[model samples]
Target: MSTLIGKTALVTGASRGIGRAIAARLAAEGALVAVHYGSNKAAADETVAAIQAAGGRAFAVGADFGTEGDIDALLTGLDAGLGGTGLDILVNNAALAGGTDLENSTPDYFDRMFAVNVKAPFFLIQRLLPNMRDGGRVINVSSGVTRIALPETVYAMTKGAVETMSRNLANSYATGKRGITVNTVAPGPVDTGHPMFQIPEVVEGTAKATALDRMGEPEDIAAAVAFLASDDARWITGNTVDATGGMFLGPRF
Candidate 1:
């Protein structure tokens, strides 16, 4: 279980949902985790406390994405938490989702979506590259919307950009020289305690739409992330590990 002992990780958006689960899982694996939150100190603290309560090491770091000085703030907090240690894993799991369909999508909305989902992660990797040790892991959390036709056009586009960024990084000279592995994890309709998941119809429909005949959970996605962060996935890079429970894998006849 201590596959990551002596390693350090930073999971963005670790305040709740999939990010929180990923943070906890990394900590459980014996990694010193820095739980990053976007303007939610209370939730971040709760995540850190849960990890500590589980006999894992974790600390909270806050930086609201898509704003000025966000990366600087994040680096400051992350550096403080690491205490001179280099990072081994960086999970770009934070994003702004939902309500970006064609009719509702505005210029501002589209720009912001790209800003948070694409630009932030790109720059983060750039800035954090120096602080990350060789053979480090960079797992970008993307959505299956890149493959599935979804109403959230803008949102999907942003994720598409993320996938591209990940692949490029995986093959880039920087990562190649440092032995860093970059990959993406795409989840399909995971139940992250959103209100929509509370509706029986929504749950049933989503479950039936998947080949697994069940709805996906945040933990499901987190498990995949943990694997990629581990040394076992050292040879796996420039790939999208689908954590969607076989969603939309043809009609179940």
Candidate 2:
């Protein structure tokens, strides 16, 4: 649990759901975590408070993706919170999820989706690389929808781009002198305390979709991120770890 002692990590969109879980897990491993939120300081504060309560170090940072100067705002807060320390881990988990299909996928929707999902992470990595410590870790959160057929076509496309970017950067940016490791974690149907999970039918269907025969939890994905951020995954890079519980792994027939 102390694998991350003296490390500093910034987890974007960590106000709730999988992001929040990742923030907590990293803190528990002895890292000073920055819980990032788009528009919810209270939720981010809650995450930080929980980490502090558990005897871990954490703070809240706010910056809305897809807006003007989002990355600048995020970096400013990060720089202040870290107090001149270099970052050891970066988890790009913030995203705009759901509701973009072929019919409703207008130009505005497409731009916004790419802005938050694709553009934000890319620039974040590029801008943070200088301030990031050598041998650091960069873990990007993707989705199982990239592989499976889903109504959120635009959303899936963004994730596919993420996978490709991760692989490219893993080889070009993180290798050799840098020694940093870049990887992606794609989660399946996760129950992130959403109201939809309250429906029995939704839960049952999602459970049946996976080989594990259960809906995934936020903690499940968090565990995967924690593993990638640790020294244990040093040899592993430019890969997408499917933390999907075997979803869409062929028919049960």
Q: Taking the tens digit of each residue's C-alpha lDDT, what string does model 2 give over 18-37? A: 99999999999999999999
In model 2, which regions exceed 4 Å deviation?
173-175
| Per-model TM-score on C-alpha atoms | 0.98, 0.98
Estimate, for each residue in 1-115, the C-alpha lDDT of model 1 and write its tens digit.
9999999999999999999999999999999999999988999999999999999999999998999999999999999989999999999999998666799888999888888
* Candidate with best lDDT: 2
Candidate 1 clashes between residue pairs 3 or more apart in a chain or in different chains = none
Q: Give me candidate 2's TM-score against the actual structure.
A: 0.98
Q: Residue 24 in candidate 2 has what lDDT?
A: 96
